[model samples]
Target: MSEKRPVMTWLTDMDGVLVREEDAIPGAAEFLRRLTESGCKFLVLTNNSIYTPRDLRARLAESGLDVPEENIWTSALATAQFLSDQRPRGSAYVVGEAGMTTALHEVGYVLTRSRPDYVVLGETRTYSFEAITTAIQLIVNGARFIATNPDSTGPSPAGPLPATGSVAALITRATGVEPYFVGKPNPLMMRNALNRIDAHSETTVMIGDRMDTDVVSGMEAGLRTVLVLTGSTTRDQVERFPYRPTRVVDSVADLVDDIVPPPPTESE
Candidate 1:
């Protein structure tokens, strides 16, 4: 049970492992190319709920990664799926951008602030006081609260910006209610992604740059995990966490040869 079965699927985090600040990290393109040619089932995961898969794919392509639309998975999608499964065609008081709205719409959710079934909070460039007030009011009145991810801040060109979890905390302090986060570290999100591609945890490897969200979630979901020191988490910071990744490396560049199987021999 210590060693996992051969890797037949992959779940990689988007920001630090593959790209940073909308720029592809060094060796990211080649690693993605290797995944594509290897014919393994994989998805690039992100906590950001601002953009749809198509948008993210285009961004990655611009950064030279060339990831497909289908290969992208986001917290927005997971949140929508969770809501749909919980209550079909439910209404929500959503606070975010097009990505969150589009996902909820696609899943047959009605966006509203009047006695909504849920108060769905996600990441956005501008988190308005008006929107926060509306969200708090809706939740206080009895709507369930759901957040996309728990990461307190997101990487940006200028600096780290307050993200979904940080805003959720404010609302919690106001109303004394907490939100159920549907993104990484939940393990539920990981299970949902695995089911999406018909993947089994024993045969999948999760690659991420942060141990708190990605690695912990993957390990809890029974998938082998790899932590790369290319994102928010540094080598020195890893020991502080109670949980550890199954493997730790400098970056994805070190993982290409380990995860990808060799091509079939010509002699055969």
Candidate 2:
């Protein structure tokens, strides 16, 4: 029989794996502590671009988890990095929030108030028709189209709210140009995270609640995938999905149990 592989690194989802809405999931903080103490590298990789790493860290800290800002990676950051490396010197017209704009600026991309080199789309709670029209105009005028993620809707304590994909769809319908996605299901985001940690594909494990984005991306990148039941995906939903994770657990606490070795015996 082939030897079982050991997972050396983890790519985790934030919203569900660590926190749910405004509350932290049970044992998430201790789980992280255990993983860190074990010398296992992990990054909180999320498709949500509404907040920067610092912002996310602060939010997580509010829920009693003190994670470093550098340990967090967002689709917004990945999108900015991809654009900075691929696109020429040009202005970015963002249809998102300050977080998205801040990410682009941090990546050395210029954000323009008028004509732009690209129309970057992301989730805006206050999406306006004027902003949509502006994006369409820019795309029609030969500006590149980019989207942070293709999530149609995001789950919330209240209910599901229209996500960035919905806005991207409207712009696509108007400009007839599909946006290049930098989020999950696209290997770009995961590759960026791996690069950040200086880890290889074989050593990484992706822990997330979504199958289509998280699990598929990890599998495609040749990483082990762990599906948790604390988010959008459920035990029943996995049966319906064609793709399957390498492992399944109820929460991040279970993940800690899977990876951590037991204490040494005194006799030894």
Candidate 3:
């Protein structure tokens, strides 16, 4: 076996790993505290494009985790960054919420319905039929298609709700244009996130709850991946996938001690 490099940076998924819905998972707060106090560079990643980092930070705080706004990364931000890099100051007809719109605005993108450069799709509680129709028409008229993530459904109090990818599929069927997804399991999201914190993948560890998105994406990005059974993926489900995580635990509660750096011995 190859020698394990000491982990110097940490990347973790927010939902399932830290908080499930509105409740904090056991040991999640302590894990964040230990990582912060240890002076380790870290970021909380999420594929949900419904909320901005500020919004998510406030939500996490309510769940008992003290995550700074900068420490949170969302698919909305990643998609915006991608658009900015590909076409600076581009225009888009967005079918999403404030998080998606805010990110594009920050990157100098114009939100319009008149022959936009791209049709951007993201998650929202309410999906407007009018907005989706506009996106389909624009795409058919030669506007490029883009999406924040490929997640087909998002969790809701009632149950799973249709998300960006589900709408993206509808538009694709109408226009024959496949939307470019900018989030996991696209490794681009992971790479962009690593650059966001100036952290190297070689010494970084990715903690996530889903093997399909988090674990696969992290593995492709050259980071060690740990799977926790608090979210989408389960212990029995792990073997069904061809690739495996570096380790599997019940939840984030099992990883609290690992974030703390070991004490130095009396080497002098």
Candidate 4:
């Protein structure tokens, strides 16, 4: 294997790598702290677009993680960035929560139900039949389609509930128009994130817990990928995938020391 360049930036998934079931995973705090102290740019990424970065930062705080709002990135933000680049100040018929709406609004997008430029779908606690019907009708009427992520289901105390991708599928079935997904597993998301931090892919590392979404996306984005066995993907399951991550560790804890800054030189 060729030698890897020194890492200057990091992108990590939220749930599996940092926390599980609303609780902080062991060593996650230290890893974040070390990353901050080392002065490396980082972002805590999540596919869930139901909550804004502030909300997510608060939730992480409740979980004993001190992540800043600016350090949190969601599919909503990625979607907003993508849309802004695609069509500056374009309007969309948005179907999501504050996270989605707020992101679009920040990018000067006007959200309306009447003759929108695009039908933007995102994650929400509740999926309204009326809204979905409107989205379907709008797509049939010639509006473009877009989605925050392709996650089919989301976790809950009750069980797995339908997510953006599931609803997007329903709209697709109704309108025969497939929505573009802009989240993980989509290199567009990674590229946007890299742009956000002004980091180069060759000197950046992506730490994630899922092979299909996180690892594959990072690899496709030209960054080193590290698989943590704390969430969706497991050790034995690694072999099942056609591709592999740059490394696999138990959790983010194993990576804390690797990011610690070097001691000052005697001349200094």
Candidate 5:
């Protein structure tokens, strides 16, 4: 009889769990391979709404990881899906890049400034004052506010750069309207990702480097969570959070043995 795997699906963060600063973490490829051979459904999640799946795949491939486009899940995609479900064929005034805008378009959302139903905010290095002004006015005009993620800063070659959450705060300050954040730390995002792969939370495992967003989200989503110390959070810092991960590892490299191989049948 084969050793039954404990988990049937996996959800992992992109930056710390798999790749960090454009380099694949040790054993990330092997972990992915193991999942492939075991036929477990998985999604590599990212809160950054700047890159599309194809873009992310290319970037990962450069880092020696072979994640398929479909395996990648972005906050932009989640935001678009949420909006589409909330209001089919809705209109929005968007402040984001191609990733966010294209996702919205794919979901049949019309981008307009004239009486839009939503003011959707997403990450972009190129935050335009004109666009921000437009979005603020739109939200004040009874337009619902939505944001891709609440990540305040993103890693960059030159250090931290302002991300969606910071920009969302600026808008909130100007309009007194807080946007509905649609990324990690929100159990809805986890549930939506699980639904995408037809996976049950009880049978899935979530891996990440952050305690607040990754661990908390997974715990709330009712999945086992793992924290790797390869990215943001540290061992000492973990104790600061009341909620904890299912386990903690040095890095993704330490997870190879976590996937128990199948045993041979008696006939064999």
Candidate 6:
């Protein structure tokens, strides 16, 4: 039998694992502090691409978690990188915000208000019929279709609200072409995070709340999976699903305590 691999690095989800909307989940900051002090490398992997890494850092700081910008990775960054590597630099019709647009622009993709080389979708609070029509036109005109993530709803303090996937679905229904996904459950985002951390599947663990995306993606990447009940997923949901995580925890706090001990002694 092959030997089991040990997890040396962690890729964690943001919304439920650490915070619930704008509020920090219980013990989130302390959990992160413990992980950092224990010398374990971790990266905040989020499917939301509405914000850049720096923007997320600021938001996290506001929520009482001091995450460094370099430690944060978003689907926007991954999607932009993927497009830059796969397609030629040209104008792109974006249905997202400044973050998604900014990332693409940084990667040499030009933004166009009309016909474009591609049509990219992400979370947009201002998703209007006009925006959907524009994207459909671009796709109908031969522009490549791509989406940051396929999350149908985004978590909020009250509940979930319409998100990128819903917008992507609209475009799909209108254009009769499905957008290529580039976020959780897809290898692109995971691969980008792994490359950034200089780690591989065997030594990495993907921690998140959703089994369909986070757990499935980690398993596909050959990385360990840890599911937390702090987000969209629940224990009942896990029981009904065929996919399973290597471990389940209440939150990141439990994970940190499990991987890092309090102290060591010389006696033995």
Clashing pairs in 6: none
Model 6, 70: alpha-carbon shift in Å?
0.8
Worst 10 residues of 2 by lDDT: 256-265
Instruction: Encode model 3's per-residue lDDT on 1-268: one tens digit a residue.
Output: 1377677789999988999999999989989999989988899999988899999999998998899999999999999999999999999999989899999999999999988999999999889999898888898898999999989988889998898888888989999999899999998998999999898898888999988899999999999999999888879999999999999999887887777563443992
For candidate 5, lDDT tens digit of each residue in 121-178?
9999999999999999989889999999999999998999999999999999999999
Global lDDT of each candidate: 0.90, 0.86, 0.91, 0.92, 0.90, 0.85
Give the lowest summed-lDDT range of ten residues in model 6: 256-265
Q: Where's the lowest-lDDT run of ten residues in candidate 5?
A: 1-10
Q: Candidate 5: misplaced stretches above 4 Å?
A: 1-5, 260-268
Compute the lDDT of residue 72 as modeled in candidate 1: 85
Runs in model 6 deviating more than 4 A are 1-3, 260-268
Tens-place lDDT per residue, model 6, 32-69, is 88777876678999988888888999999999998898
> How well does candidate 6 match the true structure in TM-score terms?
0.91
What is the alpha-carbon lDDT for the whole of candidate 2? 0.86
How many steric clashes does model 4 contain? 0
Better candidate number, 2 or 5, judged by TM-score: 5
Global CA lDDT computed for model 3? 0.91
Regions of model 1 farther than 4 Å from truth: 1-3, 261-268
- How high is each candidate's TM-score? 0.94, 0.93, 0.95, 0.96, 0.94, 0.91
Q: How accurate is candidate 5 locally (lDDT)?
A: 0.90
Highest-lDDT candidate: 4
Clashes of each: 0, 0, 0, 0, 0, 0
